[model samples]
Structures are given as structure tokens and as C-alpha cells.
Target: MSATASTQRPRLGVTFWLLAVALVALYAILVPILAALYGVSVPVAFLLGAGMCAAPLLALWYPRSSVAVFTVAAFVLPLTVSPDRDPVWPWPWSVPALILFALFVLTLTMQHGWRLGSLALLLGLMGSLAAPLLLPDAASAGAAGADLIVTASIATVAFVVGVLLAGRIRLGAELTREREHAEFERSRRELVEERTRIARELHDVVAHSMSLIQVQASTARFRAPGLPDEAIAEFDSIAATARSSLTEMRRILGVLRTEDHTAELAPQRGIDDIPALVDSTRRAGAPVDLTHEVEGEISAAVQIAVYRIVQESLSNAVRHAPGSSIGVSVTTAGDDVQVVVRNTPVPPSDPGTPGHGLRGMTERATLLGGEIHADRDGDGWTVSARIPRQPAATEVSATASTSTSTTTTTTTTTTEGSA
Candidate 1:
């Protein structure tokens, strides 16, 4: 058994208390008979029986020590308390032996695994075999020997049965663990397969469609003669944006397709790209007013997180609240950047069910050690996020320090030469 399983305390259930009560009752019954057989006072027999019975209770706390205590008691009890005249040598040992055997079996079952149980069985069998040697006279020795043989046979059978049962229990536990591990492996394999299928669909269908859009937008001016210069410039911008989106899509797909994919050659977009995103939204017929007051360099991860949150919020507004003026504000204080996006409410309509867009935004923010809140504002819906900028701030500070040290050295050298 594992160390964790072995060291854990056993629960004291109803059956445990019942067994303890039964043991005390058995001692009560055996004490009177023992006193009568030994011609001893009732109190002395009760004391000896109580001591033997109590030894087993110690197994509840210290299983190995209790087994030893009980085994020793089994041998010593008969020797100390002599039977009455015309004694049957084994009769006095019977009650103590029964208690010892019960405790031995109980300990074996309660403890995990087989090693300890096997040891308990071995000690009990040895104790049973040696019981006849403690007989007080040769005449009684013959009767004790016969009793010993019968008792040892019963104990041997009990030991074999206990070992078999313990082995079965261990086998069951092993099978349960194996089944759970197999289920986990199956689930992980299915997830990876599902992700790969999604990557393939996006690459084949979405990427191909985007590529066509980029190609058509790039060639539109040349194919249609006499196109206005402004129209040509618009087409150029469309092609550039489409190409950038396709590149980003490819990087994402590559990651899904392989575990060891390399980083993309192009840098990821950050908070600085939010203005361009807002401009695109405006071109798409959503009037977006953006206010950005962030004052320090932020990590690329935090930038991406902020950009995605704003993008999702704007997309939701356009889909659900078209013609509504959207307001996006990004501000930074100390090592934290806050982003709030709100849109004026349109006429009440089916808001549609909430879905992955909001959840994805929340998850992205959380991964960056930030938090996002999305709720209904007065006559509008609002989404806000707070992100940490400490990583980028540290890098920027280190760079500034290096530059300052270099300038100081140059100035010091120049001053000394001039002196």
C-alpha cells in the first residue's frame, strides 16, 4: 500500500464500537468461569481477563504493538492462573486464545495491504503451536497437546482465508486505479483530436476564404479601369488588413496543429493597435470614439489581452446594438491598466443568448493575471478590464538604467579631460 493510505487513521464506525462492546462482554463471561476453574477470587480472574481483552483495543491505535501485546498475553495468561484440582490444561487458555485470535484477524483486515496481515497471522500460528508447552503437569500436557493441535488447525485455516481476502481487496483497488487512468487518457486523446479537426477546418475553409478576399481586394483597382484614387487607396488598405489577419490566423492554426510549433516571425499586436481596430470598426459603420491615456510600456501579453477584450466588446456592440455610439477608454495608473468599453443602448430587441465571445474575453484577461467585468450600464452595456503592466515596466526600467550609466561615464571622462 502507499504510505498515504497506510498512515491514514481508520474510521471508528458502528461495527467497531459493537465489536468492542462484544469483547468486553466476552471478558465478563470468561472471568467467572476462569475464577471457578482456578479456585481464585472473582476479582483476580476479572482483572486478568480484563487485561487480556484490553490488549486488543490497543490495535485500534497501534495495530502492530497491539498484536504483540495480545500474543504475549495469550501465552502468559494460562501460565499465571492455574486451573482447579483435576484441571483440563487447555480450558483456562481457551478464552484468552479466542480473544487473541479475534484481535489478530481484526488487525489484519483493518490495515491496508498484505505484509502486516501476514506477519500477524504468522505470530498467531506460532503462539497457538507453543500453548501446550505452558501446561503445569505431564498429565495435563497430553490434553494440552491435543487442544493445541485443534486450535492450530483452526488458526491455520483462518490465516489462509484472511490472506486470500486481503489479496482480493488489493486486486480490486489496483483495477479501480487502472480504470480511472484509462478514462483520463481517453478524454485527453479526444480533446487533442477535436482541436486538430478544428485547426484543419479553419485552415482549409476560413484561411482560403480570407486569401481570396485579400487577392480580390489587392487587384480590384487594376481590374476596374478609371477607379477613383480614393477607391484605390481603400482597396489597398483592405488588402493590407486582410493579409495581416491571414498571417495571424496561420500562426494560431500552427499552434493547434503541433505541440512544438515555433514562434511567429511577426510580432503580435498590442494595445497600440486598438486605434487601428477602432478605425476598422468605424469603416464598418460603427461610430467608435476611443480615448487612450496609458503612460508606460506594457507587456506584449497584456497588450494582446487588452486588444482582444476591446475587440470582443466592439463586435458585441455592433452585432447587438448597431448605430449605437461606442465609447472605449484605456487608462493606466502605476502598474495597472484599465479598459472600459460602453455603447449607447438601441431599441429593445432580442439580445440573443450570451456565448463564447464574452467567456473568451474573460478567460484571456484572467490568464494575464487580470480581471474583467461585463454588466449592463444605464441605457447601455459595459465591459471593463484591469490588467497588470509590471513585467513591461521592469524591462523598461532596466533599459533606462543601462542608458543612464553609459551617459554618466561619457560625461565623467569628458569633464576629466577638459580639467
Candidate 2:
């Protein structure tokens, strides 16, 4: 009953309201005029007309009000017709009341849906048919039965049509929403498939190559007889480097395979690990000097970025400026950490396509809201970055802290195993 009393609908806007108001004014004038011709009195005729006009407009937002008004109007208006006339609705509700009442039924159906519409339709039929039976002049009135038939038939048709149109409109809106959801799901599936394919390619090609390097470097001493101590140490350093690279490659593959957060197995290298990294390069017979200045604790994310920036720079130096005195300097000032790596410029011997290292460094700095620069400094090439301290993506520290964490750092426990 609460729902039937009134429904809150989206306003059809000013133009629609203006059109509806005009229609109501037209019916308001004509119904009373026609009722007066049927011997209905001045005051009663206008009251009936007002009831018919109000029923339809109220149906738009107030179902119970429309039903009450239309039901009463349908029953009372019929008895007002003169028995001398063709009582088949008199001025015939056929021309006047029939259409106005039908409008009420049609609007009710559209606004509140069919269940309430059916109720209104049923009640309208009962009221319209019952009124003429109570008419004192109904017995002698010609075609009075036909009047009831015509009124019922028109209202029923309006109800049936309203139901069909409402169902079609509702179905159309539902289908549009479902189509949009399906399209989004399809796009997401394609993105996940693309990432999986890239991970598979790296595992098959890059991982296999790094594994071979580790195996060869590990077996070099046994393969060649009477190798010098320095050369053996160099081979051991190469093997360690290969193992470390393979480990890092596995970490990258894990990220590419899926978007989910997975447990990290090993600790990442950072500022403290810089000394060991330089020692390994020195053992490989490349002259290198390192300097550092730091105060207070730094975040794991910044530490990892700093370590990778330095590592990539050292790598570029060894390739483009081999056997040249390379300088690595790292320091912290306030909230920012700065790194500078310089080496003798290549002797016009190394010139070709650029690598992804510089791009990688720039992207890393940008992600952490920082900056990186690579430029030629006199006869030397320099790569530098100024990265602000930021929290890590995960709780895992860049380097192990306690006795228990140290053991996990060396253990291979990731989903993507070593190369």
C-alpha cells in the first residue's frame, strides 16, 4: 500500500511536464462539458471532470490516489447520463470518460509496473461495470450493456499495452549493463595472458643462458690445468656474479608471471652490500675505488634503488671503459641520497646501440619520486641519481638483520627458482 500510494520517479523534465499539463487541461474542459450534456448538473459535472483529470496525473507518482479517484469517477459518472440518449456511454464515455480513464490506467502501469497496474485495471472494470446496474434509468436505456463493454475493453487494452512496453524497456537497460561487464572481463583476461607469455619466454631463453654461465665459471679451474691463483679467484668471482644475476632474473620472472604478491625468499642487496660488490669487480682485474657517507636508517625501497643504480653504472663502466680507474661515490644529504659513478670515456673503440640500463635507472627513480642523469664529464662518462627515501612495497628488508634472516637470504625458496 505504501508503494501503491506514491512512487518517486526521475522527473521527465519541464518540456514533458508542460505537454502533460496541456493534455490534462484539454480533458478537464471537455469531460465536464460532455457530462453536462448528459444531464449531469453544473457542480457535480465539474467535480466528475476534475476527478477524471486528476486520476491520470496522480497515477504518474501516486498509485493509490489515482486508483481511488478513477474507481470513484468510473462508478459515479455512468449514472449521470440521460436515459433518453444512446446510453451506450451517453455522450458516451466512448468519447469522453473512456479515454480519460484509460489514460489513468496507462500511466499507472508505466510508473509502478504491471502488478499494481493489474490491480488498478481489475478495480476499474468492477467500478465501470457496476455503476450502470445501479442506474434507475438503466433498465429502459438503449445499449447500456454495450456501454459497459466498450469501457472495459478500452481500459483492458491500455493495461495490456502498458505492460508490454514497460517489460521491453526494462529488458533493454539490463542487457546494456551486462554487455559492459563482459567487455571489461575480456580485456582483463587478455592482459593476464600477455604477461604469462612474457614470463615463459624469459624462463626458456634468459634463464637457460645464465644457468650455463654459472656452470662454466664453476668448472673453469678443473677444466684447465695449472691455472694461476689470481685467475682461479677471478673465475670464482665470475661464478658468484653469474649466480647473483640468475637469482635477480628469477625475481623479475616472478613479478611478470602474476599480479599477486608472493613471499620473497632472499634479501635484496643495498648500501652495506656495496663494499662486497666493488671487491668482486676488483677481483675480476678491473681497477675500482669506492667512497661512501651515510647517516641514519634508510628505507628498503631507496636502498634497493641505490644498489641497482650503482650496480648498473659499474657494469657500464666495465664494458665501455674497461681497465680505466672507475670512481663510485654514494652519500646521503637530509632526505635524499645521491650516487655518482664515473669512469674513463671509451677510446673511440666502443660505439653501438644503447642498452636499457639508463632507461631502467630513470624509471626506478621516477617511480620513487626522484631523478637520475647520465652525461659525459670531460674524458669520463658519469651516471648519477638523486632518489628520495621511500617505504618499500613489502615488509621484506633489503638486507637481513638478525641471525635467522641471514639464513633465508642465501636459500633459494622463490616460486621462480634460480635461472
Candidate 3:
């Protein structure tokens, strides 16, 4: 139970005890007074009254024991009336018995649900009807057959009503819970549909534009007559870069277009592609100094995360801090790979604003059970990431490794010449 519900229990207990005490006091006074009027002994009347109150008193503390307690009280009540009386039944106690019966039904239903409460109600009705047979004065008593029938009928009606009401209450609560859950699921599905729609729109616009740029750049290199070799080379480089971006964009769009999460497509770029990334940044007019001291082969997932972090950091620097010298480093310490990218601060004309790139980098690192930190470092900005490296299940081929190494060397030489 919640704290508020737990605290209310004591208050409820106090209220029940107070109500039980008041009812017992009323019974104690009334029964003895009526017996005195009938010429019965004061002691016997008070004792019987006390006995009558015992079940309800026990019910105040042990509410679950109510059925057993009421059964005993029902059997004992009839024995209290005088044999010489015209009406041998103790009809005055009938009101108290009805009150106790109602209390038992309500408490049992609330605590144990309808099934047990209905059982207790059935037992209570039977016990009440059988009470007359336990009377010490039964041999001289007047017929109570009509009275018994009326009382039993009334109790049965009340029990049916109580059961129906309890069933309705439980059904309503269950429906409310199911409705809330369905609403949550509906909202979640709508959110996913909205995301898919946005992704498709972005793919249509950006991918088409990039593809057109690549085609135009390639066409310009061959179509233009007497063009300088340098200009043709620059155009070729632009086409290559655009083609690379289109490939990456398609990979991302493929993920967005499909609902099947386990669907696989082309392989992704990773750490081996970082040299090309740096070369592209250099071609875009930002000088980058690259360094690495990694020892063992890292998983493709970790390599991809590291490469993306570096790529985004460099892209941000080029956009917001043009003409700034950037430094990139990757080093491994035991089982962890560390990446640091730092660039000179942007001029006053290119003031920084928080964007999605930083958040994406952070999310990537966190997904790999790692962390990234980006902050202003004196006159520059620095991004640092630490990713735990897991071993790959299989080793990459020697041919692929040699090709990547040669590409890295050529890219480094080109970056040095441009610098």
C-alpha cells in the first residue's frame, strides 16, 4: 500500500472500534432495562447483553473472523429470552443481528472480493434461520415460522443486491485500467507513424538534392572543354564526396522506411573509414591533425561509434569555426578506446548554439556503455569520448586491412600537402 493508504488504516481501525463500543453500550443498557421490566434478573440480562456484543467487538479487530463470530452469536441469542413470555423469541436483538450481518457482508466483500463475501453471506443467513432451534425455551415458544420466512427473504434480497453492486464496481475498475492502457498504446503508435512520415519526407528532399549535385558535378568534369586539370580534379572530388554521402543517406533511409527492425542491409562505415572522413574535411578547407595508438581489433559497432563522433565533431568545427586548426586523437587504454577532438573557437560572427549533433554523439557513446563530454576549452571547444572495446568474433581479411592502411597513408599525404 501507498503511505497514504497505510496511514488511513489506523484511522479506520479507530472508527470501527469507536462504533463497536457505542453499539455495545447501547445494547448493554437497552437489554438490561427491558429484562428488568420483564422481571428477569439484572445480572443475567447484562451477561447476555455482553455476550451479544462479543462478536461485533471481536469484529472490530479481527474482521476476517466475522462469519465464525456471528455464527456463535446467532446460536446463543435465542437462549436469552424468557420461556414464560408470550413471544419467546428475542425479537429486540433482531435489529442488532441485522446490523452485524450488514457489517460482515460489507467488510468481507471489500477485503476478500465477491466470491468469499457471497459465501459468508450464505452462511450468515443459514445461521440466523437456525438460531431459534438453539433456544432453551423452544418447547414453550410460539411459532416463528412466518417471521423466519420474512426475515430470510429480506436477507436474500439484500445479498443479491450487494453482490450485483460489487460486481459492477469491480467491472468498472477493470474497464478503466484497460482503457488507459489502450490509450497509451494508441498514442505510442501515432508517435511512431509521425516519425516514419517525417523520415520519408526528409529522404525525398535531401537524398534527391544530393543525387542531383553528384550528377551535375560529374557531368561538369567531362563536359567542360579546356578546363584546368585542378578544376576537373576538384569537381571529381566533389562528385565522389556527394556519392559517398548519398550512400550513407540511403542506409539511414532504409532503416527509417522499414518496420521490420531485424532487417539487414549494406555494411556501415567504421574506424577504417575515419581517414577518408578527415580527408573530406580537409578538402572542405579545415586542417586536421590525426593521431592514433590503438592496439587490438575492435568490434564494428564500437568503431562506427568512434568514427561518427569524430565526423560530427569535425563537421561542427568546419561549420561554426572556419579557418580553425582541429586536432583529432584515438588511443586505447586496456579495454577502452578514447577519442578526443578539439578545435579553435568560432569567431564572434559564428556564435555557437546547442544542436542535435552533440546529443547524437552523447547517445552513441551511452549506447556503447561509454560516455562523451563536449565543452569550451579556453579559446577552443573540445569533445572527448571513451568507448569500451569488445573483441570481434572473427578477424578481418589481410587484403582488406592492407587496402585500408594504403588508403589511410594516401589520405594523410594529401591532407599534409593541402595544409
TM-score of each: 0.50, 0.44, 0.44
* Residues 127-241 of candidate 1: C-alpha lDDT, one tens digit per residue: 6556455555523666766666666666556666766776776787799989999999999876775665566446534654565566557666645778999999999999899
- Supply the global lDDT for candidate 3: 0.62
Task: Please give the range of 10 consecutive residues that has the lowest summed lDDT in model 2.
Answer: 405-414
Alpha-carbon shift of residue 47 in model 1 (angstroms): 6.2
The per-model lDDT (C-alpha) reads 0.62, 0.66, 0.62
lDDT value for candidate 1? 0.62
Question: Which number leads on TM-score?
Answer: 1
Residue range 1-419, candidate 3, lDDT tens digits:
45654654674686567757766666766575547443446676566556445644544345456657666655555555556665644342355555555655655555446776677677666765565666534433345555555556655565666677768767976899899999999998766655554554454345445644565566564445778989989999998999799768756765665452111111356777777777766655567888766666576667766877887787677656756788888777888889999998657676675544565566557756788999889989999999877633232211122112112222223233122
Cα deviation in Å at residue 394, candidate 2?
A: 41
Compare candidates 1 and 3 on TM-score and give the better one. 1
Off by over 4 Å in 3: 1-161, 164-176, 179-183, 186-267, 391-419
